[model samples]
Target: MITPGQKIIQEWYKVKEWRQFPFQQEMEATYLAGYSGLLNAPTGSGKTFALFLPFLADFINKHPDYKTRKNNGLQMIWLTPLRALTNDIKKAMQEVCDDLQIPWKIATRTGDTSAAEKAALKKKLPEVLLTTPESLHLMLAQKEYPKIFQTLQVAVIDEWHELLGTKRGVQVELGLSRLKNLTPTLSKGEGANEQVVKDKVPRFYTTDALNWNANIDNAKQNRRQPTEAENVLWQFLRGKKIGYKFRRQHLVLRYIPDFICIEKKLIVEVDGGYHNDAEQQELDKYRENELIAQGYTIVRFTNNEVLTNPDNVLSKIKQILETKSNSLPEG
Candidate 1:
């Protein structure tokens, strides 16, 4: 049986001709299981959706009448390290929400936002707000800060490694502490909800168990065996290639790439003859565009190239990885 989250994901894949990656499914399951931990995945690995999708599924399931619910309070807060990333996150989330027909609103609050925009957000809060740590701290300073976050369901810290071991990271910690205090009833391990669970079936586990199990089953259904072309490329890209780790048959959101180097945010797709079909080419374009939106540098090679001129393919990949490494910000 397909679960509600899987159903929604299927619809998304149908529209995009994509498949969800294994790590994304695991993240969704972990979130639904009521566990919070650091997501150490590289950029362009669909971490945003991994966190966002479960929250969306839970919100929709719990509040079927979310459209009728009061939209005065914030629902989720996404904190990113760079102000430039705010718009990218907002656009990506809005696209998903629109695709799912969820009437949630998304906005950004960063150092670069206009005063007028900030004032409007103050009056009517969006359901999802993407902001930087400094901007978040500023919001916490406001008199109505607690009320603003009263309805917040989740807080996603993006590019966490960039902020770790810094004063800004400490500020985020303090802000979360304050949010916890304001919503004592919603505190992680507080209150008397155990009695309600005890009154239910004796063998029942948390709803997380149901979600996790459903996701596991859904992943099995989506898994596919690699093609001969994919098999060839995997042999070359797998393990360590020039000191960087590469994953084969890796999943990103709703599509699998033949080869991916997470550190460089690079994806290599080995295409077969069928990819030349008009419809198939169209679908491939859609897939590549979506991946590019997540900051991935996509490279494509024909099956012939991978099987015959393998050295050229390896050289091309090595050059791209080296270029990306040199462009990385100095620590």
Candidate 2:
């Protein structure tokens, strides 16, 4: 019999044209089980892929007509906390969509998106709208723009841990609750609050995750009749859960980005606390010189600068994403 995990992989292999790991299986389980919880995992854990896979599978099964129009309209909204991460992630997501022959297009709409580009994006509404929390809030605030996001079946928030405790997080949770209210009866939490957070401010919980999982199961099929390939998937997943998993495979998959400058044709390195130490400072200086030697306009900011005045942070990042809206890579 195909284990539930194996069954998930079978589905992915057929639909996503991609392989599955334990993480992806769990994502399918949670999504299929009807749970809408933040996926708390390390970067490079294929977190975005995990969340997007189910949606992509559903999109192909549901909307096969996008191939004719190619790269158009508001289908999926991927929210990232930082504008700096937008281009690279968007490029990656779009490339995957291309490989799947899914004609969905993604655009970034943030404080960084130029006025002209933002206007054009609104006019076109790329199929996948990868944007920031602030930009999404802008879309939701418009009295006449509810339809812009009404078709959004799945909203994946990237770098969620950084957002879970902020005002932005509150906006997302409330927005999610609103979306659930419209689409399904999931997230039936009566906007519960303790004496302090009676206002239904942002938060997360293990119980919430469990309850949510129970619901994503609403749309998924039970793992009863998986094929032979699915049976192999089940055993593989069982081994994974038991800690007899892939040796060093996980470590090798980590992602390391070459820095980008959002201003002055520059790549900025806003330091975290780790770089404040003397040895770390020396190391950073060496790295900076190396980048500069390679014709990169590298700049650094104190961790304090990022923590205290992020207006300063936005000031630096605004330029890179302001690139022409038509500035897509050659296909």
Candidate 3:
């Protein structure tokens, strides 16, 4: 079904006196389907519009009153392989934003981008950031970078064919890995199921296989080799530092959570990059449903969150604990 967002895009095209291309429509459909893919066409075949307008559609659909809404954090990252292309790309994107009065702040962060501009981004990120692969790595390298990307809905890598198989391509891959870790839903294509099965299910399987002995073994292994994120959070929770004892890699029914406070019935999960995959997300949903059904409160944090901003993570957990405590029955 064509979404209200798609319909809005259709209206925009009519207003601009432009005809929609078949590929553009396909791209919109794919995007609305919650899948990612590489779009290929000639340099000037309205390729940018194909991807970008759909994003606008999605945004409009989500926030119908977007015009008056407060500035949201970065929602999109446009990674072009070449620094020279930033201006043209930004102009094209900005035109759409301007024409629609979308109030989106589109900025470039290439080698040529100024220090003042970079500093400004740290203070308040734009709605869309256009940058090179190298610049993207720089953003990823910054402390507490995960917060900037928490609201990121999409990362569009332009000219994938140009970057593929080169060293720059590898940089893009590495950078995307970090971004995907922060925003797991920003991913593409198959082979995820295999990775999910081999890497994820063994440690925290959530299916109806009530193999308590196997789960116990898995929990032990996980606790022994806690992920960096899990380990960092554990240090705070270990000695009842937050006024409640927490067990690491504790078994909860048919699943294993990173940390659990039995007294508060709270489960804190630290998700790795693998959890971002579509199949693993489904598994996570199932796992969370099961936990919630059993009177457990689940709070999840990405690996980047725990590693980069542990204090913020701690504060949030403490807040949850306080709220849960306040709701307790009278003695």
lDDT of each: 0.70, 0.53, 0.77
| Maximum-lDDT candidate | 3
Question: How does model 1 score by TM-score?
Answer: 0.56
Better of 2 and 3 by TM-score: 3
Candidate 1 lDDT, 14-94, residue by residue in tens: 788877888878876776666676777777888888888878876766666755665647888998877777888889889
How far residue 277's Cα lies from its native spot in candidate 1, in Å, is 51
Indicate the worst ten consecutive residues by lDDT in candidate 2: 248-257
| TM-score for each candidate, following the candidate numbering | 0.56, 0.49, 0.57
Between candidates 1 and 3, which one is better according to lDDT? 3
Best by TM-score: 3
Clashes of each: 4, 16, 0
Worst 10 residues of 3 by lDDT: 201-210
Q: Across residues 102-164, which tens digit of lDDT does each residue of candidate 2 receive?
A: 667777887667779977876678888887665664565455464565455566778877765
What lDDT tens digits, residue by residue, belong to model 3 across residues 191-284?
2212333233222112223245545655676667766777788989998999988898787775677888888889998887756644346446
Candidate 1 global lDDT: 0.70
Candidate 2 colliding pairs, count: 16
